[model samples]
Target: MDSTRTNKLLELLQTIGLQELNSSKLLSLVDEALIHVSAGRSKNFERLEFLGDAVLRLAATEFIDQQYPNLPVGRCSSLRAQLVSDRWLAQLGEQLQLESFLVLGPKALGDAAAQATLQADATEALIGAIYSGSGNNLEPIHHWLTPHWQQTTADVLARPHLFNGKTMLQEWSQAEGLGLPNYTTTEQSSRHGDPERFKSRVEVGSRLSANGFGRSRKEAEQNAATEAVQRLQDVGSEINSESPNNTPH
Candidate 1:
């Protein structure tokens, strides 16, 4: 790496709270992480992203185990899924302003719909770079990611349905012999990145249905499922309240 690019990489590390990091080898790894495949480089973020995927899962597992020791294994798995989700990684990239440092080809640069995916891939690669740069230590990864995980955990605990709505709804429907929830999605807008670009409707038998909107089809479907789950819960509450067992008798 040239002196100019090296200095820039150092600056980025500082921005990420990795201050006084002057190791050239680590800096090179970080540089590799920021390179997109479209850049036509012989080396890109692909390998690092793969490594980071594993590293991230392990780190998230450790975090959950340490923070919620009594949590059930199934719940721990669910929480880890959210923590290591591509959406979460993209959000992390946005927080770190990683787009500014990314090296993209003209095709990638002009593709707005793919921006979030690119960010997610690059962020995972960055995580891999950090872990590799630290001589395969988890300390730096934990030090950087623990706070984010804490905040995510709090949010998820407060509104658990929001994170795993589709799964929860599926389980509930099947358990009640209602079969699977059916989902139908439609594109609501042509503009990329629009929060309501897609609309989704979820139907469970003939008893319940809900609608939701989001930037992507999956998100819209999930949101619709979340609303459906909430409605089912409300109905159950009402049923229990009106039951003879809970009445004046």
Candidate 2:
């Protein structure tokens, strides 16, 4: 790579706390990672992104195992899912200001709808590049991602319902012999980044239902589930309040 490009990559590494690994091959991988397919390059980040997907999962699994050893397997699985989710990756990319580093084509630059996906893909590819660049060692990945994962873990734990509302609702329905919750989603808008782009309604058996809206179908469904869970909790509270345990005595 030329001096200017090398300097830019170095700056990016430094920004992400990876300044020590400054070799040419590593820089090349980083360069590839930041290149979108729309850039019309023969070599893009697709392969590295694929590798990064697995690497990210392994890293998340390890993080959960070490940090929350006593956590049940099901919870661990859910936590890892959040840690490696596309939404999480896109957020990370935004935090790192990765858009400035990306080399995009005119189409990609003009298309705002795909921006989040691009950021997510680029972030995953960057992780793969770091792993490959360091001789397949995961130490760098752990060092870089541990803090982020820790914060995310704490947040998820604090608002457990917000992070895994769908799962929690499903489990609640099954335990109550209510069968699985059913969800129906409809697209409400064609605008990218519209908070109410999709509307979702979730029903539990025949008596309980809630509606929610979000930028995507998954988010909309999750919101609906969250509301439904709240309604169920309210019903439980009401039943307890009406019980004869302490009636007017």
Candidate 3:
């Protein structure tokens, strides 16, 4: 490992209130150019990326537990999904300029900044690297990520349906082997902020499951999706309660 590069990487950690026990390893995590796009580089962060995905989820879960101790498990899962989402991770990487530290192959370097997935994946790998460098001590990872999670959590909590409803609904549909839910909207009024300007209906297969009215088309769709998500949760809860695990002798 280059002493100067390792020192610089450690300094980067300090800026974010993180310390690394294995600076060299952490350096490789942010080196996404090599990990994702480099053809022949045997030394890459692909393994760390896998580890980071799990680490990120664990960190988000811990954050929810600490911040919303009274929140139900289902709601907590939703919040954790928001915090650890690709969009949120990409935003964090951009905020930290993680791409600047990348060691890219020629092909990956040209348009690196615009590749959101690359950025998000690199950030997760970096988290994994941080955990590794901390000798499996989670404190460094938590310290570094908690602030980001705090801000993200607040945003998601404020806009619950907007943040995760549609995405979760899609995932739920696929998981349930129902293909994809279809959403269609109709104009209800010729006005903005009318609270009934548009109405969106969500259909599962051929059945109309839920609908919602809102000021705008997007808002209406979000409202409809939110209703669907709530309905799915209710159904899931009912199923769980009826299961053997929840049955009372």
User: Model 1: per-residue lDDT, tens digit, 97-205?
Assistant: 8899899999889978777888889999999999998899888889889989887877776676778888888877787788999999999888666667899999989
Q: Roughly what TM-score does model 2 have, to 2 decimal places?
A: 0.86
lDDT of 1: 0.84
lDDT of each: 0.84, 0.85, 0.69
lDDT of 3: 0.69
Off by over 4 Å in 2: 187-198, 213-217, 230-249
Tens-digit lDDT track of model 3 for 1-249: 477756667666767876535455556554432255453577666888888999889888887777677777876776777788776787888887776666667666565334666677778888887777667778887788887777776666455545666766776677667888898999987743356678999887853378988756776887898788777666653111110111111
**138: Cα error in model 1, Å:** 1.3
| RMSD (Å) of each candidate, 1 decimal | 6.8, 7.1, 10.8
Instruction: State the TM-score for model 3.
Output: 0.63
Better of 2 and 3 by lDDT: 2
Error in Å for residue 188 of model 3: 30
